[model samples]
Target chain A: MNSILSIREVSKFYGSYQALNAVSLEIPRNSIYGLLGPNGAGKTTLIRIINQITFPDQGQVFLDGEPLAPHHIAQIGYLPEERGLYKSMKVGEQALYLAQLKGLSRAEAKQQLKYWFEKLDIGNWWHKKVQELSKGMAQKVQFIVTVLHRPKLLIFDEPFSGFDPINAAMIKDQILELKEGGASIIFSTHRMESVEELCEHIGLIHRSNLILEGKLSAIKKIHKQNRYEIRWTPLNGTPAPEELLGRLPVIGPHYDAEDNTWDFTLELQDSEKGELLRYLSEHGNLASFRERIPSVNDIFIQTVQKQESHA
Target chain B: MHKLGLIIRREYLAKVRNKSFVIMTFLSPILLVGMIVLIAYLTKVNDNEKRLVAVLNESPFFKTDFESKRGISFVPLHGIGLETAKDSVLDMGYYGLLYLPQRASLEGVTEDAFLYTKDAPNTLVLETLEGIFEDRLREYRLQQLGVSSEEYARVRMGYEINTATFSGQRSAKGINEFKAVVGGAFGYLIMMFIIIYGGFVMRSVIEEKTTRIIEVIISSVRPFQLMLGKIIGTSLAGVTQFLIWIFSASLLMIAVMLFLDIDPAILMQRPGPGGLEASLAQSALSGDDTSQLLVEEFLKIPMGLLVGCFLIYFVLGYLIYSSIYAAIGAAVDNETDTQQFIFPIIMPLMLAIYVGFFSVFSNPHGPIAVAFSIFPLTSPIVMLMRLPGGVGEGGVPLWQLLASIALLLVTFLAIVWLAAKIYRVGILMYGKKPTYRELYKWLKY
Candidate 1:
């Protein structure tokens, strides 16, 4: 009941090539779930299945506890990685057409489109052909159309591409705002930085299989390795005491002779952080100490590379 | 259902609003009418050209036999030798020189005659000269046999076999050919419309794929719905253009002919002696009964059935062809790649037109015509060619007509189904140049 969408062992094939293989995942309601995968790793295929653009050759998908059907299309919004509006159509007209196709009435589509266009500060572009719009401008229109129907679940693939940093930040804010409005989102992208900033939960797919899935922080915690980095500088030009730091199972220790400073990383056992802190303080002034957490990017690369080596 | 309507409306508006589509829709009729008018005027001028042949007669025969005709004139050379006559004819830029040498008998004189020209003489002019010689020789032979001139005249009269239907309505010569040509013109229009607007459907699919908007749209509507919408919408635009062309072309043709005081019947002529007009005129000169019978035969054509069948065939034929076009559009990334796939789609339509005209015009009930008219792919063109003769009995059998339409419907459904399969996969595919084998694989997908 807590999950807005659930995919159960979905499998798909294109002729002899298998595009998806027994993949299963769930997205909790009102959370931004990052769909992370390398290029050609069945991420697009999974999203397409969710959108009902294509059906899985073998499996079942449920949206809001009901089997996915044509009616579910109005409840899901998908913005593909490669997206476009009709080039010859007027911006507002094209937006209205797409909205209507998503089950909005003409008057409803028009009113909603007007609200979004003004909110996005593109009110004057209503009559301009899409061909005349700048790439970012067109992206803005696409974004509006995607969310216009106010679907229960929104899927965005590479949404930040072709946008400047400022616009990207603006879009990022809008995405946050949509999520705040209680719409569950499936964010698919190769950019890991965006995932770290935005995603609360994630599913990592590699080679047509779900290799990893959990809360982002929980996954990072599991891969923590109890690793920590410490930096210290000796007081009053005292030479660095490498014997004490080395005896503490320190790794890659560095000594800056000019500044009389030392830096190194280490894996500490349970209840051993106090002992390490005492050793560092007794030897030199401790500059910094922090646990090293693996980023989503690191986890993605490690998982994919591990799978590649195994294959 | 609603989404399909929206897609159809959008597609229709997109095509109709396109600059080239609008230009071609209006401008083409004018170009067509202008071309026909130009050809008719040129043909008139060509037929007006007079060919003068100098006749150097050194015999006491054919004194009044070499008569001047509409396009060929004979000028007798007086007190001139053969070389002098040739020189004068060449100097005057005459068409040719006809020399008749003196002999003891008319047979000897006729045998020694020659018509010499700077280049090869025209076949029509040569035939005219030979006809005159044939008549004179016949008369001389009759005189030698001691037969009276009255008896010779009775013997020389031309004979024509009488014709009638079982119902006793007289039939006219060239009416079958005439009806076939008229129906063939309708068939030709369908082919052109299918090719032109079918191209519109194809290009529209390519546009959506290349723009990468197909994925977004399909996420809202089914791919089959989108493909069907495109074909229907584009064909509606085509039908609109076709109606406008027929209306405007007819209006413009009538206006041009009236303002210039030209006879359209003359335009129908083939522009030389022994042409369609000449033979029809000859038959008319024999008696007015034949011309009246021809007019009745023209009116007896089942215009209502022909028109009704035309609309049916036009829709079915275009649907079948454009679905294939839509699939091709989805399979290719750009227009250039379409060249590899376009020929096969067009082959059936071309075969329909060329084969329909040949087989239908010769014998409407012939095996070639009957088979082509029921073959579904070519039926739209060939069936109309035979329908002008009216259905049942002498015309196309009722079973054949129904079968042709029924087969077209089945074929259209089958093609659209297969095409939708390919379209679903191909629109999402990018960059790769898909072979026929790949398309076949997509059908399975």
Candidate 2:
């Protein structure tokens, strides 16, 4: 797939402290890519470089196969982690100013801002100063300014932060809508749940190295273990399932006295599933069977731990 | 170019909307002019000075009319000797007794008189008496000399110089002083505003750097553009205020001038306070006094030149210093850090104004004066005061002033160059104390 944004072996240093070390990543077009890392893991440095806020010491960044330059600044929208909206400025005015700075004509910016205002239902806040808004409400205004230009690439650092669950869900829906309309977003957040629900593809950087990078489903599958839980009931009053018990590795099989139901974990040990199923059928009726798949959080912790332990 | 226009518009609108700027602009000139008028009004005519006389002559010739004005209360001492009159005058509340001794070759009792007092009279005291005595004496002379007032005026030959220079310049030798004083004050005020407010602009830049707003702005616009915009904007504010001050000051000045007893037309028409008429009255009776030797001639001569020089210095001087201040602002992040840089900027302004004060009345065209006035940094202030008095006359060539102005322009450009470089970097830097050495390093980058 063609990459919408590319950083080729990027490395940056701050007067002796290394921020990013030969980090390469590609964000595919029309995809929501999660840039995952712990604090001080060069996530912000890479974001800043992509935004052209600072130049990297030893790397190049490209947008849509072209080298990044000032004019291209108009093509990318950045909502920095530390939201900086002018405190005393009215919300609508500030948004228009920021939009114009991104190279939008005043009339066009106003038009786009009007639609955003209506969509976010913040039309009443147009005349209110930003300082008067709560942190979450201001975030909505900031989000509007960030996307007012309809940038081809939007970088949101901690986009869901300071948002209540309802607002968070609202912003998530808007992000997905933007992504659907052909915008590629680099979503940076330490919140793994956000990554799980929002990002289709992600690159996990632990200690300045990319430990895992792939589709969300594929990554989970790569780290999956084959383990299943089974719940059953006896057909009659007989507990004569000796062959089935011997063949299967049952972790725990306890009968509930009140319900007469047996629940147990089954681990396959070189035994064919067809043979095991026939043995179980002679003694009891199987009520339920399901495999436990690893969650994204579990995979993240495991990968980070593995890398840290090895290092 | 459009960006510059946008920037200028922001400055203009923001400053115009500020209430303090509007109020100060209109108030300062009014107060300044009102103060001048107030001083003139408060300077009341003295009303309590009595004179004692012990003229030894018993003849009516010794008792010639000594017409008195408001302050003078004259006491006659006919037939009294000088010693008795002096002693008697001390007991009374009189300042002194006039001691007129007889002269055998006199053309009538003549007119001049002398007085002794506890101390020398103040200018007001001396001026009042001198005016009254001269008026009465001139009448006596016109009669005794067998000449009408018109014939005596014609015969006196009133030495005049319809002054014309080699350059075909016909000059008004009169009111030359008043013009010089006005010009010097004008130049001084303009220079003062530029320096004081220019520093404000620099401080504003430093404040922005301290706050780190520069990073956000510089990301969008070039560093040079931002700094240029701020400086130009602040200067425009100052200019607006200055124009308002001038308009208001002129109005106040006119109002005050109306109430002042100082009409140039009136003062000019009347005989100069204590000059020819008083001197003639004194010399006619007391013989020519010889104590007027030490008056500085060149110091008082060219009021016109000083005034002309002041106008040139005011604008050029302000522009020159303002550029440096702007550069200094760009070099540092805060006022505390500016302490080191400030000395270099302030020393020239201080010296120039100090020199201006002295050069106003001293040898305005002395070699030292010429050097300071032409020196680009100090010229704006020094030449303003010096030019009025014709200091260093032939030495002050046109090319020199032009050269100074040209040099100021070049210096302005250089300041902007170095300032822009530092402004770009310094504004983005946070939480660091910038040293002089570090500043140099930033310039290199």
Candidate 3:
């Protein structure tokens, strides 16, 4: 796999309290990696290490096959969770300043800022003070600043927060567009729906340890049980047979009186699936049937709970 | 290096562009000049009001002793009784009544004399009245002993011992103290600049932390660079303000002197309340040689060394103090939490000022002054107070001066290193109010 960033046995501590404990992961190139964890489970700390805002106690980080150093800061864009602009400064001036700090020349910063401001439909806000912008508008400005230099990697901590649904979707589209333009992304958030929608790979952190890290689809496939949902309507006015259903490994059987159909869930092994299908055909016509897929949210809660129980 | 320059530029612009800074820069000189003018006018009005004392004398001894002077006038009442004198004095709105009854002897006349007023009389007025009585009694005693008035006047003639340095140059009394005071003014200015601009550094740090901009900044530049940039930038703004104040105040002083039709040279030589100028003026009235020597002595002070040391101490001292300020700013989340840390930082400066003035005035070469001047924290101020004395022989010793500068530079570096550590850790920390113990822990980090 072509990886854009990799961490190996990175650990950090604040006095006696360990923030990260030998945690390690690789973020694939041109892929969105969801860094999932409960609050204060070392997600921010690890992200800070990646950004070089703080160094690790023990371990090394590499970006694009090279050791991470100060120069790599220019290659990464970080939108911290607690982010803001100089409230009294004009939007355009503040953006230019941030861009310049990120190693862009003045003229280049101005040109890029102009393009982003127009692209975000906030061109009129260039001369307005940041204090005059609403929270969502400010988020948009911050997003533009984070991506202005066209970094090789982008890290956003809860980027959707403080954004309304329509703006949030707009930002989501922009993130995908940036991915299409070939930038690796690390998304640290508790929102599983966005993760399900955007991430191709994920790492779950619990108690300062990476409990799971792999392709999102592969993890889901490994977590799924042989559970299937079935819907059928009785033909020829035949009543439902409770004994046969009870004999099988069936759960949550419900009969919809308006539609005259039976809805139920069944867990089956590979060999027993053919027998169940034949029985279902004889008893009533099979309306619909599909295997149930465990969502990222369910896997997250279940993994964390199982870890807690073991501890 | 380029990023540090950018940080410094931004910080300087932020401070200079602030409205309060601009207003204070322009308004302070006007306020200071107005206050000085008001004080001078008030002193003149106070000096103009002469107290009137009504003298009711039944004795023939003190007939001519009640002559008027600059601040007090006495009117003699020949036929009025003591009660009538008091009533008339009150009716005429006079300051007081001085009653002298007939006595058989000079001492007896003074013993019976009494001065009464509606309230406790002004001490100065009372002293003048008593001085007249005392002088007359002395004259009377001398006359009884067969000394004539002219001889008595000769006996009471004032005298002052001539003073000169061992180098055969005439030296006025209080000139050393005057020089020390002049140097102390520079020292005092340095302290104010450190405190005022150091406070700016601290508040600017706190502002960035509170606004959540510090992380973004430090990510682009080292925390040490940012802290140092802030100190240098804020001090530059302070220097700008100081330059404005000095320029405008001099202009205002010249205008006021011109409006009053006063010569600047005469004003410089004018006798102040009590100082080298007063004593020098007294001697200058007698001979041209002494006045020329006075001007020579004033010019002989090592002004070049004083100014050079001032710039050195100003930069180094401000760096040391403001780094601590920046550290404190980073350790806390808000301005209110800074109270606990500010006192220790200001204590050394206050000690330098008060102790420096006292010791440097009495004995510039004293051990106390030398020790304080060599100590890193207080040296910036106390050392300047001694620099006006010159360098090698009578002024600050060369070794002490070198040691003071070396220690200040070292202390500045060490403090900045420690401050940067705390700042690096603290800017990212939120919510909790950090303690000194926590700051120490951060230093390790």
Candidate 4:
């Protein structure tokens, strides 16, 4: 895969405190990369370095395979976590001003702003002061300004914050659309569900270190326990014999008295799924069977907990 | 550089389009001129009010001396004691009762004379009463000396002293005081502009920092570029407002002069009230052709040079001070925290005005004035204070003026360099307030 942005052994420090310690990551082109971390885990530091808000104390950052320079700021869009607009300024004018600041010509800025405003159904709010808009409406304006420059890389820190569910979904759709249009995005959020829905690649940062980094599916697969859940019922109104149940490779079995159903989880160890299915056929009627894969949330929690306990 | 232009444009448009800016730009000059006109008219009206005074003269020496004038009308009381006269005066609603006691000598007559009123009479009324008594006494004394009152009056005129320099250059007696006052006014203007516009730049910085728009802005533009753009943009707005004030004030002054049917040259010839002219008026009246010389001396002032220097100093002074103000704004989270940092920046400006005025007024060529005028921190004000005196043996040297300007320019660049460092680091800092030591560390960063 071609990486649009490469952070190589970048480190940052604030006074005596280390914000990022030898952190490195490759953001693939046209992919949504989730940056996962607890508060103050250096996600913001890395993002700021990429946006050139602040520079790393050591190491280097490369954008499009070139050493980062100030001019490269035009190629990246940043929506900070503490997002705001000038409250007294008219929405359209302020947006136009910011877009022009990002190296867009006035005509191009106006055209892009118009298209975005129309798409977001905020065309009527062009002349209204930002103070007059609801928080969600102002967020829509901020989002529009961030993307109006058509940048090659977009960085959004907690983009879904302060957004209602409907607006969140709308923003989510827009982000996906931007990615589809060939823009690489760095998505930072605490919402694992959204990460699962949106991000293709992710880097898990803990204590200023990137502990896990890869494709989302691959990471989950590497951490998988190979556990399967089974639901069985008696065929002749007789329970399965205890001896037959003992012969099966199972970890925990649960019985439901109200429905007369047997549910159990099995860990595959030197046993094939087809053999287990054949054994269950002579004992009882198999209702359902499915492999259980750990969710992103579970993996995140487990990884963080494991690191904390080790520390 | 292009982004700097965009930033400046954004700042300029934002400020110029503000409603408060528009209103203040137009309204302040009107208010200032209106206040002056109101005070002048009110004083004139107060002087025109007529007051009645009842005079009870027990002395047989003077009866016709207490004649009535335009604003004060005197009524004689016959065959009435001082107490009855006072009662009748109060009952008749007179403004005051002037009682002249029977005395054998002029000195005793003054000691015995008393004026009683419901309230303390103004100095004008008191001086008028005293003048009448003195004139009568002088006439009586001249008759006793066997000389006519007219001859004595001619002889009583004071002697005049003509002033000139050792080089035989005919100079006005009070020219230094006049030039000092004029220069002081220019200095005061520079001080006022720095204070007002420096606060403006600081407030603009604080507004952007507080609103969190600075991050988005500095992402595209360097912090130094952003700071310079804001300073230049706001100064342009300040210049616009100042120009409007000057235009409107001049127009209003002209209109007022026309409405009052007063000569513009007369207004220019005499400095305003509380000026050196008021103190010198007595000496000027005693001297031969002093008013004409005073007017000539005022005209001899190098107004073109003074105005040019004022513009240069105003720009340089504002640039130096506003950069510091911008740094303070970046270093702090709010205006309250600015107090600790602001005092040091403004101390020199305030000191310049106070020390410049005193030193220039007393001795225009004194070392203190020269030192302050050459020091970059105080030069904008002190140099203007010395400009009207002219450069040579008696005033500021041309080399000193150029050096002051050069030093101010150099200082401005150095300050901008230092301030940019603080601004770059401080704009993103939140929560913790910074100290002077911390700011020093930011310089290294």
Writing each residue's lDDT as its tens digit, candidate 2 over A141-168 gives: 8888888899999989899889999999
Candidate 4 lDDT (Cα, whole model)?
Answer: 0.84
The best candidate by lDDT is 1
**What fraction of the true interface does each of the listed models get right, in terms of native contacts kept?**
0.88, 0.04, 0.45, 0.57
What lDDT does model 1 reach? 0.88
In CAPRI terms, where does candidate 4 land?
medium
Looking at model 3, residue B10 earns an lDDT score of 82
Chain B TM (all candidates): 0.88, 0.64, 0.89, 0.88
lDDT tens per residue, model 4, A149-267:
98999999889988999999999999999999999999999999999999999999999999889999999888888888888876656454344666554555666767777887877
Cα lDDT for residue A9, candidate 2: 89
Q: Rate the local accuracy (lDDT) of all candidates.
A: 0.88, 0.68, 0.86, 0.84
Pairs in clash, predicted candidate 2: B52-B97, B305-B387, B305-B388, B306-B387, B306-B388, B307-B388, B310-B384, B364-B391, B365-B391, B365-B392
lDDT (10s digit) by residue, model 3, range A237-301: 64654655655536767878888888778887889889888888987789988888899999999
Residue B394, model 4: Cα distance from true site in angstroms: 2.7
Best by DockQ: 1
Backbone clash tally for model 4? 0
Worst 10 residues of 3 chain A by lDDT: A240-249
> Can you give the DockQ of every candidate in the order shown?
0.84, 0.14, 0.61, 0.54
Candidate that beats the other on lDDT, 2 or 3, i.e. the better one: 3
